[model samples]
Structures are given as structure tokens and as C-alpha cells.
Target: MSQNERFDNNDSDSLILSFNGDANHEFQEINENLGIVRDVIRNLVPLGAIKVAEGIVIEPVVDYVFESCKRNPNMVFVTLYYARGLQEIDHHEGDSVGPALRDMRKKRIECSELLARELVHKFNDQDLLFTKVLTKRYAFSQYDEISNRKNALDLATRLYSEMGNCGAIFLSDNEVQACVYALWSGHLVPRISRTFPILAVIDYYIPNHNLNFLENFKNLELLNIPRNQYLLDVFSYIMFLIIYTMVAANYNEIRELNGFLEGSMYLLVFSFILNDIRTLQKHGIKEFLYFRRILSLILHVILATDFALRIKHVTSFDHSIPQFHRKALSLVPIFLYWRVLLTLEAFQPIGRWLTQISRILKKSMSYYILLALAFIAFFQSFLVLENTHKRHEGDDDHLGDKNEWGIFALLVKGILNAPDFPGASKLENRFGFVLYSVYVFTVSVILFAVLLPLFMTAFATRRSVPEEYLAHFAHIVIRKVKHNQPTRYNYPSPFNLLYFTLVLPISSLSIIIGHNHIRLYANIEKFLTRIIFFIPMIGFALIETHFVNDKQDKEARDLDLRELPGLPFPEDEKQMLRRILYGLNDIKEQHRSLHFRLEAIESQLA
Candidate 1:
């Protein structure tokens, strides 16, 4: 690619990974470098071997002899020449040689493969050959340190030379290199999955800022994203839908998995949405909203297609091996549905949108269409079963026969896929309007109820809670009150409508008690269902009411405390003291009563 077309390293940064095309040339150069490396290694090995042996054994022997003969004049000369040569090589070759080799590579100096093999052998040997070179070069009585460092440097240079990049290895020392194998050997699958989105975002969308939607995609690059984050999100919506549909199918397995899957997926969805909001904070709100909307649209399309296929696959005319799955395989689509729903819910607006009917007629239309499809499937199944029994001439022989239902399916399928004809076209026209009306009504209701409320709540909170107010609120609720716990919902403000929704049950307890009664339940199923449905609602309501009420009274309580304490004393204001003391006593009594009631209710609930 041309320079302009090449990946941008700024603004719209691109990961432009290019490989060296001149592989033969690069290999030849590396081999040549290795030849020179071998010559250096061959010289160094003997020196290293001698030094290691000397450092281990000879040093002590020399010291013992020297200390016993300290007055001897010859010992001084023996030490002098040894010290000088050691210092010379330590300064010249040991310190500067590695850098000089690197510089030679930069200068494109060619070496031979023979030299590479020689160096590799010497370093690998780690015997007297390696130690002697170090002892001769350093002239140090102790050659262990010199031999170790030289061998390490050789191995490092060889690896880097072969790799071409050597970026990571060259920066660290030999000890670091040994520890790095653990990281290198680890599975890259998870990392690859996580990075895939980032690469896709940059490749497909980053360049077209006018398509500016790509800014939203940048949030995926967060390093601390939860494990199997994408898969978890997918699981959330899928599990939810699976349980929902399987409940209709009367599958016991569905119910069992539902609770575990639902709870985890819910948390996953919340985390996903929370992350989205966190991401939005980096970008402007408008862009954030746009990015979220686009993502939602994409998710919705995928979910819709999945659901459509599931219906078609399950309600097929003939069982030429179930297209989707043979057994609990249908649960896959169900799980997928749950994942999509939960993920969408992670973005509060999207979740709410799925539940709500934008227009009254739209939901009615969906119900009608659903009813029609169900009727057709049911009738088709019935006919196929009947026909199969008739062909077998005995219901007893064809227990699995379902051919009677095929006729109905064939009819329905024919009409659905019918070609436009003079008479058939007229029939289609009559039904088409009704179908369109239903679609419009359903879509409108969904938008109005589900999508609108969610967006409104989110936007309202964002607008109402200015940063200054948020800071002040945080100071009061978080710092001063020491209620450092985050709310169930990470609302922009405490004054959000969501708080109202949470508190609704607590505020209006009579509404729940009036219609719902445990006394009439005939089975645990109904009782558990009712309780499960209301538990979170009731619990959240209690929390919201308790907090919100306390929040409201806090200011007045502070004002009273601040002003009451400063009032004139009994000597100057007898009447004031009487009123203030009596009031304080009354307040203490009231507080005690409230605390008693709270404790009693908690005990009962428990």
C-alpha cells in the first residue's frame, strides 16, 4: 500500500503488521551473523570453562598460599599483571562487545553459519572451554560472573538475530528471558478473542469518522474487561430466552439451568452496560448514544433472525433430521435468545425496549401473527400425525407417526411462498394490509413504552445530575455518610426515576398485599413463582424508600443540630432551653421507636 493508504499510527491508529518479504536474504544475513557469533563463542568458551573451575577451586587455593606468604615479593608481581589484564578486558570486551556486535548488524556486516554453530556449541557446553575465554579476557581471579554474563549475552544475541524483531528479548536480561517462556507458552486464544473486536473496529470502521460510530467501538479495548465477557453477554440473553421458551416446552432441565444462568447473565449484562456508560464518559453523550443505538440495532437483527429460524426449523413439514437440533439442541437458540435479551438489557434502554410495545396496535399485531403461526403449526402437526396413522393402518404401530400434520404445513407453506397470480395476488392484497397494520402497531408500542421510557430515564438522570451536584452528592452520601456502597443501578443521580421504580413497591405495599395472597396457593410452584417475581421488587423498594426518605430528612436534621446547639443557655434564655431540651428528648424517643420498628420488620422478613 502507498504511504497515505498505509496504516495510520496517529489519530486513527492502525495495527499495520507487515512481514519481511525478503526471507531468503534475511536468513542468509542471520546465518552469516551466526558465523561471526561462533568465532566469538569459540574464543569465549575455553576462557569461561577455565574461569568457572578456577573461581570454584583455584581461587581459594591461591588465596591460602598468598595469605601464608604475604611478605614474599613475587606474590605482588603475580597479582599485578593478573589484575591489569582482567580490568582491561572487563572494560573493553565484556562491557562494549555486545553493543559492538549490534552495531555490526546495523552496518550489515556478513558472517557465516559455521561461526553460528561454533558459538552455539561453546555456550551450550558451559564447560572449561567457556570459562577459560572469560578468565583470559577478564584476567579476574573469579571468572564465574564473567562467564555467566558472556554466555547469557551470546544466547540473547543469537535469539534476537534469528527473530529479526528481538524487541522484547533485547530489552531484558538473561534471568528475565528464562521467566518469559511461561508467558510465551500460554494460550493466546482468549487474548485473540478479546483483541479481535479491537482489530475489527480499527479495520472496518475507524477510518470513516463520518461514520463516526467507530468511536463507540473503542471502549472494547479496556484491559480489565471481565472474563469471557463477550460470551457471557451472549449467554445472558440466550439463557433468558431459553428458559422462557422451554418453560412453554415443559422441559425440567430448562427450569434448573434457568436460575444459575439467569443470575450470572444478568450480572454480565449489567457489567456490559455499565462499561458502555463508562466508555460514553470518554466520548461525548451524543456519540455515546449513537454508538449504543447502532449496537442495539445490530443485536436486535441477530436476535430476530435467530428466532425466525428457530420457528421455521422446529415447525418444519417433514423431519429430514431436525435442521436446528435433534434433541435439547433447540436449547441453543433459546440460550442465544436469552443472551441477546440480557445483553440488550445491559444497555438499559435496549432491555426495556424489548419488553415494551411501542404502539398498542403493534403488540396486538405481533400477538395476532404469533397466534396465526401457532395455529398453522398445530394444525399441520395434527394432520401429519393423522395421515401417518392412516398409512400404517393402526395407531398402535406408528407411535411416532406425525404425517397428518404435513398437509396443514404444506398448505401454509404454499401460501407463504406463493407466486403472485391474478387470483392469488388479490388474496394476498387483502391479508397484506392486515399484516402491515399489525406490524406498525406492534413496533409503535415497543418504541413508545419500552424504548422511550428507558432512554428518557437515562437521559433525564444525565441531565439533572450536573457534575457539581454529583460531586456534592458524592461527598454527602459517599464520604460523609460513609455509605460507600454503589447502588443496585449505577444511576447518574440519586433523584432518578429508576429510584422511583425501585421504591414503588415499598411506597405502595398495600397494592401488593391487596391482590396477592399466600393462603390460596395449592402448590409450591405458584407460591415460589409469585415470591420470586416480587422478591427483588420488594427488596429494592425497601432499600430505595429507606435511603430516599433518610436522604430527604438529612438536611433538616443537620440544620436543627447545627442551630439548636448554638441557642442561648438556660441563664440567658430559660424558655429556649426548655423547648430545646424537650425537643431533643422527643427526637431521641422517636428515633428509638423507628429503630425498634425497623428491627422488628427485618426479623419478620428473615
Candidate 2:
């Protein structure tokens, strides 16, 4: 019979008391059974038979081992070895059995001094092994559960103290989001320092950090990633500005530069279209057609029309007025400004605040609608009064003059304060004069007084506990961004669209035909696709090195100093030591003074 089968058939009382009583032969048998069980577990796949073995064999055996160690403390070294094997198995299985192991440790099965040393040695060895496993696993799969990710981050941080670049691997999107969520939820800020290395890398890649022309340019170089969709929008907007500046200056000296700009603008427009299509696919038509997206669509239309008009103006033989082309180009800046505001949605804090503001405005929409109706009513009243008391063509007071009570002037003056009091009295129609007075009284007094307080109340009611609200908002943002599958979020312009349409599907089919190993196939395809685009990325990185400086280390040091609790002052070593001594002397003097005052009080009491 197999050893496992023989062990299973053994009496439970014999297994338990073999270590408890003085049965040397039975003790040897239990030790052999443990060795066999360990061998079986060590050979099994991490998540495979080991889990079954853990329940059927390992748990009961561990309990027997613990009882035996308790009865004969000299056997504690054997228990430690068994614990080490269990930990190794757990590590391979992603530490899912950690709680059970922790419970076993808490039982505190007895041990001798020599065996205790062995346990400590085992613990140190396991810690090093766990750290290595965590560092490697985090680099490959950071999207795991939060607890595992946190442990990995802690290990990375420790290793980074010993080896500089080891921590950079933990700067994945999942890690950053996790850190941000922790900080915003009132966790200590120092926990996020682990991600600083990666943040520095991103900062190096995209220098300005702020959303501007330079940042858009950097993002353009990263067009292979899906998260840079808004960056493409920003780049297109900047290109519009560039084209506008060129036309306004009438500088056509560098044809090559202009051609490059034009080609880049076309590419950005294509990227914008593909990004929009992706958004539509992910969110569906109803949710996709938000106000900002619609505004973007309108801007693209304007750009397309402007581009066509400019092309016609350039290609035509006749040098005509070009009025329409100029008109269309003039509208570009206005639309571009709107797109810039839309791009701010990617920044978490600002985006959350803007979303709250939008919600408030939506809730208060009826108030604004009523105010608009009131204005319309007042405007119509003023218009009718001005027409009824129309002056003759040869009148001394010209109607076009600023002081004249024209329709707009009357409405503005009445709504602001009251229509010119004397001018209303001088009107030919008494009924018009009375109508103007009532209109001013209704708008300037009742409407203004009522609406101002109503809006204030609405705003006040929306106020919340700032910290809790911020924490909640941050949690939502982290979850949303993490789960949104932004790994494929970027692909530059024409090439990205082609890759999605042609390359991805063909590769997917090949994988299905070969073995139906979906994950392996997808990973291989992603690696190959990224490798193809990485060539240009490398060139971009080389060019970027010229602009990016070595000042990040200094910046990181400054940030560290700022995070320290006390107000820190820079000084030479001698001066700092002198200051510390002086501070100690001051504390001594204060203590002496307090003691003297206490003696005086006691003497008076006696």
C-alpha cells in the first residue's frame, strides 16, 4: 500500500498520543508520516492537491506535531521545520492559508531553548524568501487584492532602502490608486513614499506635470497607452492654437515645420476619433453622449471644416477674398478653450469638485430657468415702453446715444437699480412710465431679494463634512479607475486604430486555433504589440533626456524634508550640534524655574 494510504488508515488515538506518551517507535512513525506529507506538498502545484492535502493530512498532522512538541519540548525543532514547509507552500498559493498558519502560531506549542533558536532562524529565512517572492510577483501582477498589494509595497519599500531601483516596480497604476486612496482616507501620508520612484519616472517622461502644451507633447509620445486619450485631445487643441498663430502671423517661411504641424494635427484628430469610438463602445451611446463629449464632437467638426476651407484657399488658382476660411479659423480658439476644461476631468481632486459643482447646478436649474423668464419679461416690457414713447427723427436727444432709454439700456438700468427716474417722468405715455416703474420694482426688489437667498440656501444645504466627503470621493475614484481596464487605453493615431481592427483579432484567432489558452495568448500579443511600438518610444525617451534634468533627486529630498513633523532648518554640522545643546540647556532652565516655584508654593501652604 502507498505510504499516504497507510498513514490514513492508522488509528487517530495512536497518532495523537504517539508524541504525547513515551512510545519511541510510534514517535518515529509520526515523524516519517510528516516527512512524506511534506514531500507530497512540496511537489504539488501551488493551488492544486496541496489545498486538499492541507485539509485531509496537513492540518491533523500539524496538530499532532504541536501536541508532541508540547509533551517533549526537545522536538520543537522538528515543529519549526514543518512550519517552514507549510509557509513555503502557502507562499506559492499566494498566502491564502495565512490565517490558518497564524492561528497555529498563536497556540504557542512549547519549545526548548535550542529549538527556539531554530524557530527564529527559520523565521528569518522565510522572511527573506517572502520578500523576494513579493517583489517579483508585484512587478508582474499588481492588480491583485489590496492586502497582497500592500504587503508587496511594504516589502518593496524595505528592499529599496538596501537597493535603490527595487521599489520602482511597485509604481503601477493599481499601486498609485491604492496609495492615493489610503492617504485621502486619513491614513498616514508616509505610506505613499514607496510610489515616489515611479512617480518620478512618469514625471521624467512627461515633464511639465500640468496639463499644458509641453505635457501634451510628452503624452503624444506615449500614444500607445489608452489612458492618454485626453492627452490626445489636449494635443489637438494645442495644434489648433499653433495653426491659429501661424495664420495670424502670416509667417510661411518654414514650409517643412508647417507640414509637420499639419500632419501631426491630422494624426491627433484621428486619435480623438478612435478614442471617442472606444468610449462609445465601453459606455454605450446614451452615457457616451455627455455634454463634454458632444462639445468635443462639435469642435472636431469645426476643425474638419476649417481644414477643408484652408486647403481650398491654398490650392485654388484664383486669389479670392478667403473670408469664409478666416471666419471658420476664428471659431477654433473658443472650441479649443472648452476642450482644455474637459481635459481637467482626469485630475482626481479637481474632477471630484467639478462633478459636485455640476450636480449642484443641475439641482438648482429650475431657479435659473425662472430667473431667465423674469429677465425676458422685463426685457419685453422695456422694449414695448421704448417703442410707445419713440422720439421723432429730428429730436434733440439722439436714440443711439448711451444715455437714451433704448430697449437694452432701459432693461439694464431698471434691473440694476431703476430706469433713469427723470427720463421715465419725461416720457410722453403716462401708462408706459407706470409700466416701467412696476417692472423695476418687481425685478430689482422682489426677484433679486428672493432668488439670492434661495440660491444661498441651496448651496449651504449641499455642504458636507469635508474630510469624510473627500475620503468617500477618493474611494470611488480609485475603484472606478482601477476596474475600468485602462491597460489598453492608449494607442496613438492611425496605427492604433489599425492594430485594433486588424492585428488584435488575427492574433486572437491564432491563439484560439492553437490551444485556446486565452491569457497566455493575450499576454504574448500585448508583449509583441508593445515591442513594435517600443522602438519609437525608445527614440522619444532619448530625445526627452535632453529636456529632462537630474533635478528629481533634489526634489525628492526636499519633499522628504517637508514631510517631517518639525520645522526643519538647514545648518552646518557644528552649528546644528550647538543648537541642539542650547535647546537642552533651555529645557533644564525651565525645569529649574518650575521646581523653585513649586517649593515657594509648598512653603506658603505649610
- Model 1 ranges with Cα > 4 A deviation: 1-327, 346-349, 355-362, 365-402, 419-606
Clash count in backbone of candidate 1? 67
Per-prediction count of colliding residue pairs? Answer: 67, 5
lDDT tens per residue, model 1, 367-473: 45654665465455444444544555644443332244434433444335442223222222444234433433543454355445455545544432222122222
Score candidate 1 by lDDT. 0.33
Q: Pick the candidate with the highest TM-score.
A: 2
- lDDT measured at residue 588 in model 1 versus the true structure, 0 to 100: 100
Top model by lDDT, which number? Answer: 2
lDDT of 2 by residue, 1-606 (tens): 998877776866677776555445544644654454344333432332223322333324434444443433223323333444333454466546566554342222112111222222222222232222111122112233322332232332232222222222222222222333322221211111123322111100112322233443343324432233334445556665676566556534322235665656666666667767776775568644456778878877877786777677777744552567656757867776766665565454565565555545655667667666777886676555455555534463544442333556666777677567555554434765786677777676656655576567556745532322333333333333322323432454445665676567867787668855756765766565556555554544443344333332222223223235376556677346645755786899999999999999999999
TM-scores of the candidates are 0.17, 0.40
Q: State in Å the error of residue 291, model 2.
A: 4.7
